[model samples]
Target: MDILYLMILCSASLAAVFLIIFIVNAKKGQFEDDESPAVRILFDSGEIKEKENNGNKKDEKEIGENNKIEEKSE
Candidate 1:
């Protein structure tokens, strides 16, 4: 009987801790973007790559180097 009471108290404390953590996260906007993340994986990476290739955008390294050179010139 004593062991049963101890187990109940332990379980209740663990439940309260988890509940507090969930409430804190919920209040902090952690759960706000739930829909976007689920849908984001459905987007086609191949389509994104095709768009990037069509744009002829400079690579990140070249862009960074160009910015550095421009800053030096100014």
Candidate 2:
């Protein structure tokens, strides 16, 4: 029927629109750095560890100050 033809035309146009968007994104480098994102967690974890190490130093300093305060109070 004519309805089938209309449905086919609508689906084809929708597919074309999606394909164009995909092509534009691909050309604009949207998919170029796919590998970095996957490996980013590995590198990011090292940076987090470094930050945690730095934070620990501050915590130790605070603890030392607390001990000094306790000694003074006693």
Candidate 3:
């Protein structure tokens, strides 16, 4: 009875705090440009050149080399 009331009050206070913070930050434009991260990865990094120029095929070459190096130690 009293415990349930205390728990509800505590949760309501926490929710109010979070809601206020969210509204304040939202008005300040903190989340305005959310799409930038998902779009940014579409651009190339230097790894594409290594894969193309050497026919290195990064995924297979990297995994194979790592396995070979580990095996040599035993």
Winning model by lDDT: 1
C-alpha lDDT of residue 54 in model 1: 57
Candidate 3 TM-score versus the reference: 0.56
Each model's lDDT: 0.81, 0.78, 0.81
- Candidate 1 has its poorest 10 consecutive residues by lDDT at 44-53
Q: Which digits, one per residue and each the tens of the lDDT, describe model 3 over residues 44-70?
A: 565764466467446777766865775
User: Which sections of candidate 3 miss by over 4 Å?
Assistant: 45-74
Please list the residue runs of candidate 1 whose C-alpha ends up more than 4 Å from where it truly belongs after superposition.
45-74
Model 2 misplaced stretches (Cα beyond 4 Å): 45-58, 61-74
Candidate 2 lDDT by residue in tens digits, 6-40: 99999999999999999999999899987888887
Better structure of 1 and 2 per lDDT: 1
For lDDT, candidate 2 versus 3, the one ahead is 3
**Clash count, candidate 3:** 0
lDDT of 3 at 3: 100
Query: What is the descending TM-score order?
Result: 2, 1, 3
Could you tell me the lDDT of residue 32 within candidate 2?
91
> Which one wins on TM-score?
2
